[model samples]
Target chain A: MTDLDLSALWVSVQLATTTVLVLLLVGTPLAWWLAHTRSPLRPAVEALVALPIVLPPTVLGFYILIALGPHGPFGQLMQLNLAFTFTGLVIASVFYSMPFVIQPLQGAFEATGTAPLEAAWSLRASQWDAFLTVISPIALRGYISAIVLGFAHTMGEFGVVLMVGGSIPGQTRVLSTTVFEHVEAMEYGQAHALSAVLLIFSFVVLLAVYILNRRFPIHAS
Target chain B: MSRLVAQFDVRYPTFHLHLDLDIPASGITVLFGPSGSGKTTLLRCLAGLERAPHGFMQFGETVWQDETTGRYLPLQTRPIGYVFQEPRLFPHYNVRSNLLYGYNRIRRDMRRIAIDQVVEILGIGPLLERRTHRLSGGEQQRVAIGRALLTSPSLLLLDEPLASLDIQRKQEILPFIHRLHHELAIPVIYVSHAISEILQLADRVVLLKDGSLVGVGTLNEMLTSLQFRGSFGSHRVGAVLDAKIIGHEPQYGLTQLDFSGQRLFVPLQPSAIGESVRVHVLSSDVSLVIGRSHSPTSVLNVLEATVQEIREISQSSVEVLLDIGAPLIAGITRKSLVTLGIKPGDSVFAHIKTVALNEEVTD
Candidate 1:
C-alpha cells in the first residue's frame, strides 16, 4: 500500500478509537437514564439519540459542520474553528455512531431490572457502589457490544466525515474517504484492496461479537 | 423487650393499607396474610424499598421513618438484610463472591457476622466456587440468605424466601431459616401465606386481611383464638401448643410431650428429652364428647376440657374453643352440639387423634 493509504488507515483507526471512548463515557449515563427514567420525555430523548441511525450521514454532518463553524454557537463559546480539523472528524463520528453504542447499552441496563440493585442497597451498598458492583457487571455484555459496534461504525464513516472533514491527505482523509477518492479517480485496484480489508475487518468483528455472546450469555442468572 | 413500632397508611388504586404494629424485636415475627393482603408491601416498607409518606417506623432506638419530622433513611443507610422471594444473586459472581458482595461492603469494625459462620450455618461451603446460574433454586436461596447475613444487619426481612421453591427445595431451605432464628441475634420479619411456615417459624404472629391488621399475638394466643381461625381456612384451623419432649417411647414408636401438665403422644421425633417442641393440634382432629367416655378408644390423647367460647362456623359446623389447660379447638357439628346440650362452662373430654399431632421445632 502507498504511504497515503497507510496514513488514511491510521487516521481511521484514531478517529474510531477516540469516538468509541467518548461514546462509552457519555452514552453510559444517558443510556442508563433512558433505561430507567419514567418521565414522558424519555421517549423523545431516545428518539433524538436514535435519529442518526435513520438520517443520512451527510444530513447529520451538515448540521454539525454549521454548529461548529467559526461564527456558530459552539465555535464562539469554545473560541476555536472546528471545521475540517481532526477534532471536527471526531465530533462528527461520535454523533454518527451514538445510537449504535447507546441502544445496546440501554437494552442491557433495562434487562437487569431493579431487583439486584435493591438487594445490594439492603445489603448496605450505596447507590454508587451498587451500580459499580451489581449493575455494571450485569451490563458488561452491552458495553462490549456498544464499544465494538461504535468503533466499527465510526471506522466505516464516509458521507458524514466527507461533509464535515473534507479529504485532506494525511489529516482529514480516512480509509473510507480514501477509497471513495480512489474509486472516483478510476484506481479500481486500490479501491478493491481497501474494500476487501474493510469487509474482512467488519466481518471478523461481528463474528467475534456473536461467538463471545453465545459463549457468555448476557443474563448470568 | 425491644420492639419495632410502625404505623403505615398507604393508598393505591386497587388496595389501601392502614395498620399499626409493635413487633417484638427478637426471634421470627411472621406477617401472615393472603395474597394482595399487603404483607409483602409492609415488608418492603420496612426495608425502605417502598416509601409511605404518612408512615412512621422505629426499630428500638433508630427511627427509620418519621413523617412528622420528615426524617427518612434510605435503604442503604438502614442496617437491614432483605431476602427477596427470588434469590436476586449477582449472576456474574460465584457463590463465594456473592456472599462477600455484602460482607465486604460493611465496615470491618461494624461487622457482627463472620463469613465463615454464615457459610457454615447455611451449609453453602461446597457451593461457594460454583456460579450462581449453575446452582439450584434451594442452593441459590441458601447463598442469598448467607449473603444477607454477612451484611451483619440489625434486622432481617425475608419476603416469602421459600415461596418460589418446590416442596423439596422448600424443605431444604427451611432448616437454614430455622437455624437463623435459633442462632442469630438479629430480629427477623418473615412474610408468608403458608400456615405451615407460620407455625414452624413464628415467635410472634401478625395476621392481616384486606390490608388491615387482623390480630397480633403469640402463636398459641392467635391459633387458639376463635376470631383468627376463619382466616386460616377450615382445613388449617388448629391450635399451636408449646410442649416439651419428656420421653421417647421407642417400643411404641412415639414421643411423649408434656404441655400445661397434660401429656400427649406424637410420632417419634428427633428432638432430645427436655427440648421444647411446638405441637399443632388441628381442631378438626379433636372430637369432643359431652361426658367422659367409659369405653376403650384408639385415640391416645383424651383430656378433660371446659368449653370456653362457642362460635358458629357454618350452617352445619360449629367451632368450640375449649380451655384444656392450654387452649384447644374442636370443629363439632351443630347437631352434636345441640344434641349433647354442650355450652360454655360445660365439662367435656377432648379426644385428639394420635396421628394428627404434628411436632415442630420452636423458634
Candidate 2:
C-alpha cells in the first residue's frame, strides 16, 4: 500500500478509537438517564439524539460545519476555529454515530430494571455502590455492543468527515474518504482493496458481537 | 417492652393507606392481608423504601422517619434487611459474594451475626460457591435470607418471601425461616396473604384490609375472633388453641395435650412433655352435641364449652363461638342450632373430629 493509504488508515483508526471512547464516557450517563428518567423532556432529548440516524449524513455534516465555523456560535464565543480540522471530523463522526452507541446502552439499562438496585439498597449499598457493584456488571453487554457499533460506524463515515475535514492527508484524511478519492480517480484496484478490508473488518466485529452475545445471554435470570 | 411504633398516611392515585401500629420488638410479627391490602406498602414504609409524606416511625431508640420534624432516613442508612418476593440476588455474583455484599459493608465491631452461623442457619453451605442463576427458587431464597442475616440488622422485613416458590420450595424454606425465628433476636415483620404461613410463623398478627388496620393480636386471639374470620374467607375460619404436651401414649401412637383443664389427644408429636404446641382446629371440624352424648365415636376431643355468641354465617350455617377456657369456634347447621335450642350462654359439648397440630411453631 502507498504511504497515503497507510496514513489514511492510521487516521481512521485514531478517529474511530477516540470517538468510541468519548461516546462511552459521555453516552453512559445520558443513556442511563434516558433509561430511567420519566421527565417530559426525555422523549424530546431522545428524539434529538436519534435524529442523525434518519437525517442524511451530509445534512448533519453541513449543520456541524456551520456550528464550528468562525462565524458560528461556538467559534464566535470560544474564538476557536474547528472547521476543516481533525477535531471537527471527530465531532461530526460522534454526532453521526450517536444513536448506534446510545440505543443499545439504553435498552440494556432498561432491561435491568430497578429490582436489583432496590435489593442492593436493602442490603446496605448506597446508590453509587449499587451502580458500581450491581448495575455496571449487568450492563456490560450494552457497553460491548455500544463500543463495537460506535467504533465501526465512525470508521465508515465518509460524507460527514469529507464535508468537515476536506480530505487533508495525514491530518483529516481517513480510509472511507480515501476510498472515495481513489474511486473518483478511476483507480479501481486501490478502491477494491480498501473496500475489501473494510468489509472484512465490519463482518468480523459484528460476528464477534453476535457470537459473544449468544454465549452470554444478557437477560439470564 | 421494646416495640416499634409506626404511623403512616399515604395517598396514591389508586389506593390510600392510613395505619398506626405498635409491634413487639421480637419474634415474628406477621402483616396478614389479601392482595392490595397495603401489607407490602406498610413493609416498604417501615423499610424506608417508600416514603410516606406524613409518617412517623420509631423502632426502639432509632427514629427512622418523622416528617413532622423533617427527619427521614433513607433505606440504606436504616438498620434493616429486606427480602423481596423475588430473590433479587446479583446474577453476576456467586452465592458467597452475594452473601458478603452486605456483610462486608457494616463496621466490623457492629457485625452481630457471624457469617458461618448464618450459613448454618439457612443451610446454604453447599451452595456458597454456585452462581446465583444456577440455584433453584428455594435455594436462591435461602441464600437471600442468609445474605440478609449476615448484615446484622436490628429489623428484618420479608415481603412474601415464599410467594414466588412452589409448595415444595416453600417447604424447603419454611424450616430455615422457623430456625431463624428461634435462633435470632432480631424483630421480623413478615408480610403474607397465606393463612397457613400466618398460622405457622406468627407470634402476633397485624390484620389489614383495604388500607385499614382491622386488628392486631396474638395468633390465638385473632384466629378465634369472629371479626377476623369474617375478614378472612370462610375456608380460613378456624381456632388456634395453645396446648401443652402432658403425656405420650406410645402404644396408641397418640400424644395427650392439656389445654386449660381439658385433655386433648393428637397424633404422636416429636416434642417432649411440657412443650407447648399451637393446635389449629378448623371450625368446620367441630360438631356440637347437647348434654354430652354418650355414644361411641371416632372423635378424640370432647370438651364442655359455654356458648359465648352465635352468629349466622349463611341461611343454612351458623358459627358458634364457644369459651372452652380458650375461644373455640364451631360451624353448625342452623337447623341443629334450632333443634338443640343452642343459644348464647348455653352449655354444650364440642366434639372435635380433627385437631391439626401446628408443629412448625416454637416459642
Off by over 4 Å in 1: B272-275, B287-298, B302-307, B310-320, B331-349, B355-363
**DockQ, every prediction:** 0.70, 0.54
- Residues A1-221, candidate 1: write the lDDT tens digits: 78999899999999999999999999999999999998999989999999999999989999999999898788999999999999999998989999999999999989988888998898888888999988998998999999999999999999999989999987899999999989999999999998898899899999998999889875556
Weakest ten-residue segment in model 2 chain B by summed lDDT: B354-363
Stretches > 4 Å off in candidate 2:
B242-251, B255-264, B269-277, B284-327, B330-353, B358-363
Question: Against the true structure, candidate 1 has what lDDT?
Answer: 0.88
Q: Best by DockQ, which number?
A: 1
Instruction: Give the per-residue lDDT digits (tens) of candidate 2, residues A98-166.
Output: 999999999999989888889899988999999999998898898898999999999999889978898
Best by TM-score: 1
TM-score of chain B of 2: 0.85
| B1-363: candidate 2 lDDT, tens digit per residue | 888999999998999999999887888899998899999999999999899998999999888899999999999989998999999998888999999999989989989999889988888899989899989999999999988888898998999999988887886787678778777878889998887787778888999989989999988788777667665456768877878899999899999999998999999988899877778888999989888667787888999999999988899999899999888888999999899898899999999988887534221
Candidate 1 lDDT, tens digit per residue, B1-363?
888999999998899889999987888899999899999999998889999979999999889999999999999888889999999999888889899988888888989889888989899889989989989989998999999999898999999999888877887877678777678878899999887788777888999988899999888788777677666665668887768899999999999988888788888988799977777888888998867777888888888899999988889999899998778888899999888798899999899984344333121
